[model samples]
Target: MSYLRFDKTLMINLEESLPREILRTNKSGAYHCTTIVDCNTRKYHGLLVIPVPELDDENHVLLSSLDETVIQHGAEFNLGLHKYQGDNYSPKGHKYIREFDCEKIPITTYRVGGVILTKEKIFVHYENRILIKYTLVDAHSATTLRFRPLLAFRSVRQYTHENPHANREYQEVENGIKTCMYPGYPELFMQLNKKNEFHFEPYWYKGIEYTKEQERGYDSNEDLYVPGYFEVNIKKGESIIFSAGISEASTNDMFEKFEEQAARRTPRDSFFNCLKNSAHQFHNKQGGKHYLLAGYPWFKCRARDMFVSLPGLTLAVDEVEEFESVMETAQEAIENYINNRPLNCKIYEIEDPDVLLWAIWAIQQYANATSAEQCKEKYGDLLKDIIEFIHKGKHDNLFLHDNGLLYSNGENKAITWMNATINDRPVTPRTGYIVEVNSLWYNALRFVAGMMHTGDKAESIFADSLDELAKTTAQSFIDVFLNEHGYLLDYVNGQPSDWAVRPNMIFTVAFEYSPLKPEQKKRILDITTRELLTPKGLRSLSPKSIGYNPNYVGPQILRDCAYHQGTAWPWLMGFYMEAYLRIYKTSGVSFIERQLIGFEEEMRKHCISSIPELFDGNPPFKGRGAVSFAMNVALILHVLKQLNKYY
Candidate 1:
């Protein structure tokens, strides 16, 4: 049995299979995603989705899906699945699925009587292309294959209706055809490795429903245009390759290209390998610059997510070169922010108050990975500049107080990572001295001070100032955030401290430098474990807290409200585990290992071999938000790295 294989019993059941999605990315901004049965349950699901920078920032769906039909003895058996209105699924191709596995690439086998066909899919790295190779595994008689491509040349966020404006024409290319639905969109070039007959039957497949969208209270219906069907003959033990891309390709080399791409895939054979593979998928290289995408399907390169996830995604996987590549781009963005120039890179929210702090923490991880000397030689000036930037009050919202704690005026904005907003106003307003922000601030100051003190500048006045300021900040942190309940307050504004039991306090215990004593750290950790910990991860808020919404459901407003109220985020587990191992040493290893089993079981659930953005806090803890999240995958890899240290 393969690690990620599903037999007919699970593959044929819509209720069981439809929710389990699979995602493949090209390392660029292009991707191919859908359910295990090839049924698109979300509008974001597609066979070929790529970013159209010429049009806009959002990803555009080019080839929505490809439906295959197997012909034997003049009887056509459609091996395609589509959900329509009135709880109807036409063609019902999932019933023919004998097995589905993704250990290497996503492979689906269908048995239609005596004919058994296998389809394998791969997204070509660094290109906007998807290749699907169909093999006739077994056949007793002559067989034929037909492929119908459903096109939806629209933004992933919106759906297209049956309209008269669509171009109902296509140009014949080598072994296939190319078409463009809209004027501004790029032409979708679709081809096969062998000769095929093109049947021009342009029509609209209307009223296709995405049940996931409906459940989330969004527009769920769309009309996809089918240009035509390609008919080709096949023999037993022979394979044919189909390619869909934004640009044209050589028909003869499609097979070789598919094999080359497959050869590069890190098989989803184990939990760690699954995480490593998912981590690499988040790497988006564009315009000769490297970046880490925040999450898949709908997310872009976010500054906080990029820095926070950078070390684990690269360093924990032993990809030190990749770590430096992303940092090179991120450093440029930070420089642009400091110089008050427009950021030429694609990183979003570089101006966030805590992003620089997180960037310093990433460098700390690098220091641990290699050596303090190497980190100082490479990122010393960058660290000094960040601390100076904060101390000099150069940031717009962040201010340096006389008592050494950092304050941000997040009155109407969502400054920290609890950043859900309603009508542009913060839903969970953590305005004043945020616990995590100050915790990270103190850690950065202490780490930089230690580095500066030990480096060539042993008698540096700047190092002395940092050490002095760090001590002051440590005292101020305890005075402002630590409450009588022995747990840290989420944030303090002087009006009335926001005493929500959030995961934000975990940073104080997780970071290398801490303001609290060992007993105090233990107290905070115990409270966090008691109130916020869950099988999925640490919940954003405690259930004992008021306005705790445990389930992430309903419409946009409702979901946003629950985004940080009580939603469990897996990335926090990275910090929670770090704190655990640091405090308990070898004794904590077994407990942490047992806790990781829940995440390991997740390898076969939801999105296979990938971690999601968030999960419901309540029982069942259904994975929600983005199907594949960079932070969750990276942090889990970080935990595994920490675990390996004990062994």
Candidate 2:
């Protein structure tokens, strides 16, 4: 049995299946996302969603869905599911699904009276195409299949309604037809491997509702355009491949293309492999530059996310070349930022105060994965430049004080990653001598000092100066951040120090070089484990802290308010586990391994084989936010790597 298989009992239940979404992405920023039972609960769900540079930077949903009908003996069973208004589901096709499994690719089995059919779907890598192969497993009599394509030519951020400006005309192609609903949009080419008949019947399917959107306090209802259906006959053992893409493909080679793509997939047959497969989906290649997307359903190439996730997503999986390729692009962005020139790459927020610090840490991880020598040979200059850039007071917000600690001005803007905004103002504004930022700063200084202390005389002299600066920074870090309560303060501005217990202090113990004493580190970890640790991860703020909201739900403002207050973020678990193992060594391995049980169960939960952005801080700890998050997945992989070292 497959590790991610769903039986009929779960597949037929709307409540159980609708929340379980499946996502498939091509390396070129195209994806196919929907529920396990083929129902689109969100406007972001689609059969072919791709990025169109001419239209905008956002992804557009071209083919919303494909409704399939099985016909025999003049009886038709429409096997497509869509939620309408008033909690109504048209056709209710999920009742016919016997099983759904996605070990290698998404495969669905359907049983209707005397016929058994199997549907397998795959997204072609590095291309804007989706291929679905339908096989007739067992049939007593001849059967015919009908396919109707529902089109939504709009950005994922917006919905489309019935408009008179839509072009209902289509051009006939080989065993298919191509149509463009708008002028700037690319024409959608939907073709079948075998000969089929297309009937020109353009109609509008109105009032299709997305429950996920409504629950999030957004507009939910939209209309989809259907441009007729295609009918094709099938034999008992015959298989037909359907292709949907931005460009036309050869009808004769569709079967071969599908097989080639399927062969490249890594089977999600186990917990580790599931994460490994999901990690590869975040790779986006555009304009000869490689980038790591922050998440699926809605996110882009954010600089902080890329640096934080690069090592675990690549080196942990033993993909050394990919790590170098992505870093090459990031290196360019860092250089451009320092030189005061426009970044030619696709990365966003390169000027964030902590991004450069995270970049140095990413290179440090590369050193840990391979060797310090190899890392220095490749990225030594970049590391030196980053340290020099910050030391010379070149950054906009990050200022080096006389105390040797870096301070950031987050009073106006959300400078750090805890950044949640409302009405263009920060909600949890952490300013001046933040815990993680200074911890990262100290680690970077010490690391560069070690890397540059080798043979060159000038480099050795620079390393000595860095050592002196690190010592001063360490003394000030203990003085300003560590309070009398045995736990570190979150941040220290002009006002009374914010002594809230947060996951930010975990970095002090997790880094290889730390400013805190061993006992001081132990006291912080004890406080963290007691107050902020959850089965999912570490909470942003302790429950005992005032203004703590444990759940992330309701409208936009409410969700934003609770986003970082007390929500548990899985990415923090990586640092927490590292601190535990570093302090307790082999004695803590068993305890840390058992802590991962909750995350293992999540592999079969929301967004199968992937990790979500966060979970509620309260009981049940249900997943919320983006379905598949890059940093969450990557850090978990890093933890797994650390565990293997113990064995």
Candidate 3:
């Protein structure tokens, strides 16, 4: 899920490299320290430790992924705002500055406090002023884990860049640099002495390097990483300020201006808490979740992704009644898509098909949380239309399948984002029956059938049909999807479908409205945990999978191949947690509880910021790809809500 970086964009923080943080294991065996850093701030947002850690001064050292391990030091931004987008430019403002220092910061719990709850505070040991916040939020409350992780600053300095090409588009007939200011810590800052420094620095993943002497030197066209250095003195009993604004040349000005702007703008926690509370209310009363973050799909202007996250974000925060309203929104979106094709006649965005399944999966959650009468009465027409649309295949109904799986390609093929591609190449390039889709279809049918039964239509027939469909699904599609290997195929209908273990089955296992039996659910959990589970979350595909991409790099084909190949997606952690809960409720909670107790701490540790976008599966592993999705945030809120169960 996305966290607020100093840049102000809700993006992923894929910069955790601390072995302990990235390893997902705490110093002691019992707790897993899920520590996240705001890659930009280089400050600890919060942390999760299993069995809890006995906080010592050492525990307070903010760990960084990019900090050269040899140097063992950390860095922070001096944005006039105290935040940074990348090390290169001002956040959305796109303006740039060369310096600032870590000084006073503001913070408080968001609820009773102003829109931004955190107020400035000072610490003893480090003597660095930083912001601190304590919150129940939505996710972790279900479990009895108290988060007391602290964040502080060690040191940070600034270097300026002379980029004449700052705003100029590379492909837009651009020549000569479009100059703009950028604050960065390059080798030039690094002291020749290695002892008092962090060995590592932020290399522009795809950046041009420069030398202080060569601001307009002969090496003008060449991009180089000018070495830089600085120091952070986190002496014992010290703290650093976590400023509300960024680290621009004028920290005080940015703070004073943004503090007022922040005051005028929508409150940070309000936006977050609104999404959470609204979702929680819906889940509690409606019994289902609005899977989409913002709005829903199809006609009437309600989009697909928007509606699904409604419950997860809205309800999880506090809006209980909106659950039904969101479900209503989903109804309208789905019905319009089926009957009218407003979203897409084929529902294909580029060359992928997962969005459709994701939308359907959302509806399943919506139905589960709402009353049969409410769902049927409000969304009866919408449900029928969606079902009819799924049934009505392309090419004038000539491409219908008995089992109900969508095929973007001619055959019963699979091509979702996970298996999608572009430029005649697959981002995922999946070709065959996949696992998540069919499972979603089966779940959707049962939900619609049950809803139909509740309607004034012929109930008995729909119920029996649903039962038959369930039986058929249990016997055929399941076996077809899952193989003798015990691992589910990334896709079927191929000579040997890729037997990649992923978080695909979490939905079927997690959702109360799934089509799996007790034994099958147990198996799904076992496979998922063994292959996909990581301290951060579930990886897109197991490293053991042949197709897994170990590194994040290259062109569209290369990147797309790596997209779902072996990326560890933290967002899936919520689903994995939910599925684990479901399995425990049925069987005893032994294995699941064991996993959860350990995972509770693991979830929090080493996550740069609440969550990093993705991480390398290898040790001393570092996070990569830095854009967080709302669902990941929603998942955290949901998990937190579940934590309240213990209380």
Candidate 4:
């Protein structure tokens, strides 16, 4: 169990950094181009920003990837203010809405892929769903700088969308150069200079070092004054390509100016507070505990996502309501997900699968933390609904799998988040074979038993069943899910799966209700730490495996091939932390303390600001977002709750 520690007075105020210091890798194992970028945003997701390249050459500059689109904005969105570009406002002139701007927009590597053959400084800053790639020519003598705030919202469109580049799903289409340069919406620019507002100093974050310039705040003010961002430059010939969405502009004057304001100003909110604030944002206003699914900050209505994201949001946020609400929201969501049942109707906007053990784990957290009154009053309905869903048996007749596992079968059906495939091919199609599902099932049962009370027959039965399930899981699932040496396999059908060591298996090795023995836990953790762990997070699969993908971007098939094949998933780091804590608490290994302490240290270097979705598997690996993934960071904060040491 974890505890909470809140040091509200501790503030993060980052001052400066050399843009050239940023070196990022793309999904294709290729060096994305670089520019001397000066970008500042307060939040990790970068709601506002001011980005432009300090480039050395003007003629050789080739701009491609840029994010220009209308997101949740203003008065009602921005707390009611006159927008930028109002009669009294000014529009940002240097912004470009792609497709409408120039050349082509391809999903090949990035939106734009070419070289800048200039002798002047170039700075480019923008936002979007796609990965940004820049390839510089050697002829240019320039120190390049790049700025990327792990931005990209989780998407769950009502319908499937055509791939940005390749229309087909399966194969990586390595062909032509189809481009779209149509008229599109400009960036939103909002009015600043408010007497009382959330003011942000660009590029400031928690737990990281930077140059600082600060003025003490007075309680007379509303809250921490968070402002948008401003960039300071010393380079010449620096031109930034500000790009985003393609569409007809809104007639709303407010929207028009907000767009203009957005192009000019960049959001440089505080990642320290943003990390804590974003987590707290998930709960309802009244605070009893109910999830927003995804909030306006990203895509909305993701129940399972919200539940799994609870640890991240609720951890150390200086609020307990989020914890209560999350339990309530998940209770509602589990029923919803099960009601449409298990067919592609998951609590998420994406494919519905049976891997809900991920969400169930959150439910266990709720039971462990919080009060009984809170649970019964707010989440009672949710709990009953979820338990009913489980009792009814969704996929694999899991209620009867008695073998202690849950899974699915068939071609197009889903059983986990790894449902996406190249074209028609399903990335993970394990029809049978017992697995981590049972471990989650057992944990859920034990969790419910505790929440239900001591004398309840159902509670006793659930506890008894938990023991049985753990036994069955250990007897059957262990060997089935693991390879000859005990490293975990991706999954199990009848025959052996490629026997690859994937991060998903880390759940069993890491969680408190782990199905593995003490020895088994040790081996798996070592393997994970050495092979699967990257500077960013845990790789989906071993890099040495045939299925491994060094890069994170490319054709659907290529990306999916790497999805569980090798791309690193930062979200899993929380569980990895959980497992590390479990091992440390037991063996009393001094190394465990280092892991506990090191988790935060690593975060300070990589994920300390906010957790990313996935990272490239290769050297100089960069982060890749499967969805607007920020929950894992929150989860890490949640897991840290158990620490005895001071943060």
- lDDT-better candidate, 2 vs 4: 2
In Å, residue 42's CA in model 1 sits off its true spot by 0.8
- Which one is best on lDDT? 2
Where does model 3 exceed 4 Å of error?
A: 1-308, 321-333, 341-357, 367-370, 394-400, 403-414, 419-424, 459-463, 553-558, 586-609, 643-647
Candidate 2 per-residue lDDT, tens place, 1-647, comes to 77989999999999999999999999888999999999999999999999999988999999999999999998999999999999999989899999999999999999999899999999999989999999999999989999999999999999999999999999999999999999999999999999999998999999999998998999999999999999999999999999999899999889889899899899998888999998999999999999999999999999999999999899989999999999999998899999899999889988999999999999999999999889999999999999999999999999999999999998878988888999988998999999999999999999999999984999999999999999999999999999999888888986987877888999999998999999999999999999999999999999999889989999999999999999999999888998999999999999999988889999988999999999999999999989999999999899899899999
TM-score of each: 0.99, 0.99, 0.54, 0.55
Estimate, for each residue in 387-478, the C-alpha lDDT of model 4 and write its tens digit: 55665675333444556565556355545556556557677665554355555665665555555554368656755655555567566667
- Please write out the lDDT profile of model 3 over residues 596-616, one tens digit for every residue: 342234232333222344666
| Best-to-worst lDDT order | 2, 1, 4, 3
Sorting all predicted structures by TM-score, with the top scorer first, yields 2, 1, 4, 3
| Evaluation by TM-score, superior candidate among 3 and 4 | 4
What local distance difference test score does each model get?
0.93, 0.94, 0.40, 0.41
Q: Could you give candidate 1's per-residue lDDT for residues 1-647 as a string of tens digits?
A: 79999999999999999999999998998899999999999999999999999999999999999999999899999988999999999999999999999999999999999999999999999999999999999999999999999999999999998998999889999999999989999999999999999999998999999999999999899999999999999999999999999889999888888888899888889999999999999999999999999998999999999999999999999999999999999998898898798889899988889999999999999999999999999999999999999999999978889889999878789988888999999999888888899999999999999889876655377889998999899999999999999999988888967767999999999999999999999999999999999999999999999999989999999999999999999999889999999899999999999989989999998889999999999999999989999999999899999999999
Q: Model 4, 76: alpha-carbon shift in Å?
A: 34
Model 3 TM-score is: 0.54
